[model samples]
Target: MIHEHEWQQWQQQSANHAATAAFLLLDVQTNLTMLETLQAALDKIRANPAAEPYSLSGNSYFIQLQPHRVLIEELYGDDYAEPVTLSLDDFGDALAYWHTQI
Candidate 1:
């Protein structure tokens, strides 16, 4: 279940961008509880990776790199068995930089 604060945020964003998809960017190591909450939230909306249209839920996904192993999972949509992982420490900054260029 989504918390009251998160629900309100989702509602506000949905209302503000009716035609655009909302994405949830979170730090995987911020907190264990928060990570679990995010995982549950994403699981609720996850889609089959093999389905047509190949869409994700709410435009949210997770990326993690540990040692030589890179893990990628669609937090709210379809995901492939293997995820494309890159070397990056600050996910938010990378996303923001990409957004500016795009």
Candidate 2:
């Protein structure tokens, strides 16, 4: 299991990435890279504006040698949250749902 400090580090790094819109070093999987995920998320944000009816949106960032994935919720009013989990499906669904609330 990953230590709590890792989560804190990830949170800080994520905040930095969100601000700079730059690629971040995340744990990678056999098929996915963290940088790739961040890029995809950036693309999604660009494509979907935070307007009424489409406020729910987020990005799934991965890490290497770890089972859990990070769910970054881009909520309305500039209030965002990152909840880490081991299930990709759950993160994806939750992000989709969150986007609708915005």
Candidate 3:
């Protein structure tokens, strides 16, 4: 499980991108395959070009994807939150990092 400090540190890291954040969070929270989450995020973006920064919310986290970047936000209580933004390349790096972790 991810601790609060680790989550906060991730948000501060300039290297952490959208795909990395999504995969890490999902891996901890569910048994779904990583490809499933990646495909879902891509599908959401392709299905709604107008929603450039489209978002998907899970029980405790949310991810917003844009053409060149992505944002991952972790929700706490009713209003508290932590968010991180990443470029496409950084996001790819993040995905690779998580894959290794698994």
Candidate 4:
């Protein structure tokens, strides 16, 4: 589970980056607990090599990394009402940096 401090830091990073949404990409290799999966996901994101982006229903994006997946949603609402396609490179860079801060 994410500690209070970690959550606070994550919120700060999200605010700094102006991120609309964030999701954890759990590792599927091991039968890990929720806390462990969360931690592993965070670690992998920090060292993420590359990510593949897939469009999902309802203006959502799924970022896949092997056995893990990060879903970024609400990309085309309110703050971002216009249709905008964020580059994979940009997303990866932002995600990596955001994970590092957390």
Most lDDT-accurate candidate:
3
- lDDT of prediction 4: 0.38
lDDT winner between candidates 2 and 4: 4
Q: Name the regions of candidate 4 deviating beyond 4 angstroms.
A: 1-80
For candidate 4, the 10 contiguous residues with the lowest summed lDDT are 20-29
* Shift of residue 92 alpha carbon in model 3, Å: 1.3
Positional deviation of 45 in candidate 2, in angstroms?
A: 16
- Model 1 lowest lDDT segment of ten: 15-24
Per-residue lDDT tens digits for candidate 2, residues 48-75, read: 5342221112243322211233333333
Question: Model 2 compared with the native: what TM-score?
Answer: 0.23
TM-score for each of the candidates? 0.24, 0.23, 0.52, 0.29
The number of the candidate with the highest TM-score is 3
Off by over 4 Å in 3: 1-32, 39-54
Instruction: Identify the superior model by TM-score, candidate 2 or candidate 3.
Output: 3
Which of candidates 1 and 3 reaches a greater TM-score?
A: 3
lDDT of 3 by residue, 4-54 (tens): 446546545653443356546654334337445654665566567565566
Residue 63 of model 2 has an lDDT of 27
CA lDDT, every model vs. true structure: 0.34, 0.33, 0.57, 0.38
